[model samples]
Structure formats: C-alpha cells, structure tokens
Target chain A: MKTINKFKMQLCAKSTNESFARASVGAFIAQLDPTIEEISDIKTAVSEAVTNCIVHAYKEQNGDIYITVKIFENNKVKIIIRDKGCGIVDIKKAMEPLYTTGGSERAGLGFAVMESFTDKLRVISKVGKGTTVTLFKEIKSK
Target chain B: MECKLNMTDDTLTAELDGEIDHHTAKNVREQIDLEIDTQTPKTLILDFSDITFMDSSGIGLIMGRYKKIKSIGGKVKIKNPSPNTYRVLKLAGMDRLAKIEREE
Candidate 1:
C-alpha cells in the first residue's frame, strides 16, 4: 500500500485528551473527503480507542497515548492508538458489549463500535505491558 | 459540554449540548443525576438536539441514566439525536430502554 500522508502524536492519557484526539484525527481524515457519516464513524472509533487508554490502560492515572494516522491508496485510512498500561485479560470477553470492567459509567461497547464502523479492527495486548488498537476504513464520499 | 434542564408536567428534560465524550460525560452525568434526584420526575427526557458529537460513552451515559430513572419508576426519552448518534444508540439496543424520537 502506498502511503500518501501520515502523522504521529503523543498525548497524555486523560479523559480531556479524548476529544482532542477525535478532533485531530477527524481533521486529518477530512483530507480524504469522507462523507459526514464516514467521518463520524472514524471519529467515534478514535474516541473509543483513546478512552480505553485513559480508563483501562492508565486507569486514569498518568501515561502517554501514541496515535498514528496513515492515508493509503484507495482512500483507505488507518489509525493506531497505543498505551503502555494494563492490558486485557481476555480479548474476546472484553469485546463483549456491556461487559465492562470500568464500572458504572462504561457500557463495554468500544471494540464492538470500532468493528461496526470500520473496515477492519485489530487488537494486540500483553497483560502487564500495554494494548494497541488499529482501525481501518475506506472513505467513499459524495 | 452544557446541559439545559427544564421540568414541566413532571417531565424533566435535559437539553444536552456540545460533544459527548469520556472527557465531558462525568460532568454531564453529575448534572443530570442531580436534577433527577431532586425533582424525581415521572419522565427524564434527554434532548440531543445540540449534541455535535457522541461516542459509546454516550451509550454509557444513557444506560446509566435509564437505570437510575427506572429504579424510581420513571422513564427516559432521547430526543433529536443526529443520525450518526442514533446509529450508536440503536447498535447498543438503547431504543429498548428509552423512546428515541427523530428530529422533533
């Protein structure tokens, strides 16, 4: 795949940074001329991944979130969100909707939403080290 | 994020404005819960007309509120969610918990 454009950012793993991550990614993805719905899907996917870093990865403590966005041939966009925090015990179980470990304010639909909104979703984890989520989507805009 | 709340006919309507994300949800939850606890209304309406962005965190917000309102014998109504937001709500099966109205 030929890379057209790419950028990387490192942000604090905090709830406040979630919107910043979404907006920054949304802006970068805009160059592909994605439809409103397409952009929303990407933004939502980014938010979910970043929020996971804050809530589950760092546990609201303090860490760094790394995001890399890539634009490839055929208007395909790829995003990687990573954190060096507590990884999931069971990827399959954590991906289940409403099976949250983040307590009352979480619905455990992060991975599900990413799967539904994007063309491909991938998760990699090591229990004591970190987790990385990659999201891919092709923009077919009007 | 900002929420405008009103109570009429025992219905407490919260007009949620701005993006609903993990960063802002905590404050929004506190505001709505405070009103729900005080008024104890028969209905809790969440107006999303002004919400510009939402993620799964929005689902968590709604689900938590639904449980809170349901325990008090009240119901929840989600109003004017953008099509994108509605898709998320439907994906999570939230329509079964709250009555969602489109563009009213």
Candidate 2:
C-alpha cells in the first residue's frame, strides 16, 4: 500500500514505556492536522494496545514491541502494534468489555477502548507466537 | 502524574495533575488507596482541574477507587474534569457510579 508518510518504532515491552509509546504516536499523527479530540482518541487507543503488550504479552519477561504508523493520501491514519510474546488464547473473549486476564486491577477495557476510539480495529494472535493489532482512523480535515 | 491528597474530618480530596495513562495509573491508584485505607473517609473527591490527558486506564482507576470507597460506606465524586476527560469518563459509564461535578 502506498502511504504519504510513515514512521516505525521499536520499544521494549515495559510498563513504564506505555505513555511514551502513546506520546510518540500522537506526535507523529499531529502532522495530519487532527482535532484535539481526534488526537486524544488515537493516543488512548495506542496506550491500550501498548499496555496490553507489556502486561499480557510479556508476563514474566520483556520483549520487543513494534509500532508502525502510516498516513495515507486520504488523510487516514493506520497504526499497527505488534508483540512477539505469549499470544492470546482467546481473542473473542479477550475483546469483550470488562473481560480481562489481568485480574481485578485490570478493568479489561483495553481492547474495547481501542475499538471505540478508532474507525476500525483488528486483532490477530496465535498461541506461543505473537499478537498483532491494527487500528485505522480517518483524520478530520480542518 | 502528580497526586496531592487533602484530608478533612470526613472527606478526602485528591488533586491530580498531568496525564493519566497506564504508566501513571498504578502510582495514582496506590497513592489514593493509601489515603483511603488510612483515613477511611466518608467521601472521596478526585479533582481533575489539572488533568491534561486520560484514557481507559483512568476509568479503571476511578472505578477501582469507587469500589474501595463504597465497600467502606463512602462515596466517590469527580470534580473539574476537562471536557475531553469528562467525555471519556461518561463514555465509560462512570457517571452512574460517581458524581461528576462541573467546574464552578
């Protein structure tokens, strides 16, 4: 697919880096001239996806998290978050709101939040392999 | 994230600043929980006048605190949430669990 602009980053799957991941994505997408609300939506979705990798993917160890942002000519933004850690056993159940494997402390709203904030969301995972999440958003033109 | 807790005879008001994400949510929860556990106040108010950003993690933080305070026969209130933060909070159905006070 042809993209007008693209940026990729690789960060360790650490709890402390979740904000950094979101901030980086937000900064990259700013060039699209998105509204403040649009930016907030993107940042929130990125945070959820990155936090999932840190908390669930690498339960006992650290792994690499790959983030790719692509801006198409149509002013659409696509974000891909990938982690090569313990893949999800059940993607269906995992996307359900309030259904979390991370226990009481986790509200299990990560996937739901991402889905709500973006125009499209796709999750693909394989046990013992990895999980990849793709998100799409149509940036409103000013 | 910056958290400041003010304790009255029966109320605990927490002034939170900066962004609230998964990275900062843990610390925010712990700080507030420590005060809630120690004082067992009759009410807990979260002041968000200075909160610049928040996500679903913020929702979880508030919900968790609501559960804790309710268990102790207390209530939770949110004050001075920015328009964006308030929208997110409402979308999470937090208004049903706690009182969301508009800035005066």
Considering chain A alone, what is the TM-score of candidate 2? 0.97
Candidate no. 2 TM-score: 0.96
The candidates score, on chain A by TM-score, as follows 0.97, 0.97
Question: How close to the true structure is residue B70 of candidate 1, measured as C-alpha lDDT?
Answer: 93
For candidate 2 chain A, the 10 contiguous residues with the lowest summed lDDT are A100-109
iRMS values for every prediction? 0.7, 1.4
TM-score of chain A of 1: 0.97
Tens-digit lDDT track for model 1 on B39-93?
A: 9999999999999999999999999999999999999999999999999999999
| Per-residue lDDT of A136 in model 2 | 98
DockQ of each: 0.91, 0.68
What TM-score does each model's chain B reach against the true chain B?
0.97, 0.97
iRMSD of prediction 1: 0.7
RMSD (CA, Å), each prediction: 0.9, 1.3
Highest lDDT: give the candidate number: 1
Best by DockQ: 1
lDDT of 1 at B81: 96
